[model samples]
Target: MLGQERSRSFTATAILFLLPAVAFYVVYMLLPIPMSFYYSLFKWDGISPTKVYSGLSNWDEMLHDTIFWGALRNNIVLVVLSILIQLPIGLILGVLLTSRIRFVKLFKTVYFIPMLLSSVAIGLLWKYIYDPTFGLLNSFLRLIGLQHLTTGWLGDPATALFSVIGTICWQYIPFYMILFMAAIVGIPDELYEAAKIDGASDLGCFRHVTLPLLRGTISMASILSLVGSLKYFDLIYVMTEGGPNHSTELMATYMYKKAFHSFEMGYGSAVAVAMFAISLIAAVAVMGVTQYDARAL
Candidate 1:
């Protein structure tokens, strides 16, 4: 009876400790999701208390909106490029840093510096770097006598999306690098030694042992990349405001424009809800595929 009482007391203390965080999450996160879903079914300018029931009209409109589709496509482009380019680069860098490389600490710090900067700041910095008139990029091109290649990067529709994506990769690659590095460091050295004893080359050990061990971290990084790409807003907003004819507009930026700029709160809520659905779907799909792959392996 005494032992049972002590167990109950411990359980009560644990619940008491968790209550504050759970309350905050319910107040700020959980409640807002349902509220957004409810708002999505109404037509309101946000100022009027009268919410006209529109049913699925907002969703219907979003489905037909070409601009919204374009923004979504741009988001997908970011996700694809991040998975293909960013992850590989980060993985390579992580491997190199973990190997018998010189100045490992210095290299890690330098690589991680970009991730420390605010997205807005990084956007502004890259904006200047890509500037056509008297910008570093154009100036360098001119110096190298490639003046023909120098054009307004951000202002040009052909290059705006790619330029912004490059900035996004630069800002985020370090994050994946650090993530991968941590996972790589945690791997048992005994595995590597065993591979070496079996006459496995460096590449062989990495291909067979390291890559398999890092599968979980890779899946995590992939999910994070996908979700973040879908909701990407700050840097793009600060850099272009989805400008140059909406070439770089993301779903989040479009939602903001509808909600605050255009005063279409209901429409914005619908977009937000749609984004939430898409994020959940993408995360689940990626996780499912990774799990299947792991099982197959």
Candidate 2:
């Protein structure tokens, strides 16, 4: 009877400790989802005194919206490119940093400098670099007698999306690099020592030992990159505002324009909800696949 009473007391204390976090999650995360969905079913300007029930009109309009589809396509491209570019480069950098290289500390600091800056700051800095007239990129191109290659990077529709993507990759590569470095640090050195005893080359050790062990980390990084790419906005917004014929438009940027800029709150809410749904689905799919792979292994 005394033990039962103590168990009850302990459970009560645990509940008390968890209540705040549960409440926060409900208020900030859970509540907003349903609220956004509710708002999406209406035609409100967000400043109006009345909300007209549109009943899925916004979703219908979104389905037929060309720009919405384009933005989604851009997001998909970003996800693919982010995974393809960031992971390999980050992995290489991680390996290099972990090796017995000179100036290792200095190189790590220099590589991580971009991650230290605010997204808006990076955006503005890159915008200046990509400037057409007297900008670093164009000036260098002219100096190299590649004058034909010098064009407005952000202002040209053809290059705007790619230029913005390159900047996004540059800013985020360091984050993945750090992640990979930490994962690499956690790897058991004994495994490498064993491989060496078996006459394994450095490349062979990496291919057989490192790659297989880092699968989980790679999977997690892929999911992070996927979700982040889907919801990306700030840097692109600061740099181009989805300009140059809407070539650089992302779902987040488009949603912001509709809600705040165009004052189409309902449509914006629909877009936001759609983004949430897509992200949730993609995350779940990746997680499931990773779990299946783990089980197989």
Work out the TM-score per prediction. 0.90, 0.92
Query: Relative to the unseen true structure, what is the C-alpha lDDT of residue 114 in candidate 1, on a scale of 0 to 100?
Result: 94
Residue 146, candidate 1: Cα error in Å is 2.6
Q: What's the CA error at residue 235 for candidate 2, in Å?
A: 0.6
Which regions in candidate 2 have their CA more than 4 angstroms from the true location?
Answer: 1-19, 197-199
Model 2 TM-score, all chains together: 0.92
Q: lDDT per prediction?
A: 0.92, 0.94
Per-residue accuracy of model 2 over 88-196 as CA lDDT, tens digit each:
9999998899988899999999999999899999999999999999689999999999999999999999999989998999999999889989998998999999999
Task: Kindly list the per-residue Cα lDDT of model 1 for residues 171-229, writing each as its tens digit.
Answer: 99999998999999999999999999999999999998999999889888988898889
Local error of candidate 2 at 175, Å?
Answer: 1.4
Winning model by lDDT: 2
Which pairs of residues collide in candidate 1? none
